[model samples]
Target: MSVAGEGAGVDTGTYRHAMGRLAKGVAVLTTTAGAQDHALTANSLTSVSLEPVLLLVCVETDARFHDAARESGVFGVSILAADQRALAAWFATPGRPLPGQMDRAPHHRAESGVALLDGCLATLECDVRDIHPAGDHSIFVGAVRAARLAADPKAALVHFRGQYSALT
Candidate 1:
């Protein structure tokens, strides 16, 4: 391992290997702009502040949803429940059959017009506060406009060591 303060030795493979062991909740990030909807699976959701109800979700710069998010200035996050692994996988897929991925699943729109997936453990409608470039992704800082919890509670879907598991 490299010494602290020195950016040597650790490569992308090594970093990914280490981070892959961390358990993380999965969520689908969605945005709609110019009459088009986009969504992508992400595990990089986190609350940045509570006073303003701010949160952040990182989107790959190359993902289809990236431009839509930037243009829309609003997005939605649907935290997947344990049984929604298929939904998570579907959104994560690249070049997925079109007619739109949302067509393959049930979803609703937030007042801001962001698509919120049905059957999620929780959903948050957010307005983009800022965007920061980070490595190969862009971190979107959002202020939560509205939040909702599923009618029924269920275990969460988590990813660890390249696999999915239920947080029971």
Candidate 2:
């Protein structure tokens, strides 16, 4: 008896549309290589193991952030607040310039040496614990070096149904 989720029968477009219903918090993944900084907007971040304090971010193979994350061996996650919609969209843009891109926003360095955007609802600094390639994207597992709550926490920014919304 084949189930509804069984292979080939599920079309990619349909699968994507179905998953779009999942409301997820939006985060900006950041890394630095030498003097250069790279970042990508990701909603694929999820807590993996509580004992080890691990989290993972899925990055496309061709994305610039992928290479930076691997090489730096460290990264930062800034959980955007509702007021940070513009910041989220800026980092999400494709083919944006690498240099001076970071200057476009206000941020500070985490202990892990990665940039953490200011005005976020929360922040996490992490050291790369492991990496696994899954299909078109690579999952980078991070061991939390430090986690912090905003000085004044605000509503979370969420992505659902191919749009960004405030989770108030």
Candidate 3:
């Protein structure tokens, strides 16, 4: 049965309303596994810790790349700049070819050889530390092995209420 229904008279809308109140920064989660590259635009990313350099990204349980992400053991988190709206759309749309997919986006591979997107505000190369199943999603916790920030400051692209917006 239904896990949420197990509780007596729980208001499901409360969960949705609470989540809607939380603002999140958008990012592109990328990985190369089994001779193919996969990227998805995601807003479900956040820093979990600093002492051990941990971050987390949540992927839908039925996403096409979910298995790849699980098996690859590594992934890249690219914080999209405000100017990269097109890039964000490209990755977010399934069955659409990524622009410049043929040519690497001025990136160097991590030790795991996962291609990280370039020209981002920041990039984190990480090794998968744990995967926790959360509702209809899988939360992948990663240990940051390498990271770099752009020399110049730039606004970040954010997704909210089903649209892409830029920081002022």
Overall lDDT per candidate, in order of appearance: 0.90, 0.91, 0.81
Q: Which stretches of candidate 2 lie over 4 Å from their true place?
A: 1-7
The TM-score-based order of candidates, best leading, equals 2, 1, 3
Residue lDDT tens for model 1, 66-153: 9889999999999999999999999999998535779877998889988899998999999999999876899999999999998887
Q: What is candidate 1's local distance difference test score?
A: 0.90
Against the correct fold, how does model 1 do in TM-score? Answer: 0.93
Q: Which consecutive 10 residues in model 1 have the weakest lDDT in total?
A: 1-10
Q: Which tens-of-lDDT digit does each residue in 1-168 have in candidate 3?
A: 247556467677876666766666778888877788877889888889999999988999888667788889889888988888887887787776644562634566767787777778998999999999877899999999998889995888887666778985
- TM-score versus the correct structure, for each prediction: 0.93, 0.93, 0.84
**Best candidate according to lDDT:** 2
Residue 34, candidate 1: Cα error in Å is 1.7
Q: Candidate 1: where are CA atoms >4 Å away?
A: 1-7
TM-score between candidate 3 and the true structure: 0.84
Ranking by lDDT: 2, 1, 3
For residue 118, model 1's alpha carbon misses the true position, in angstroms, by 0.8
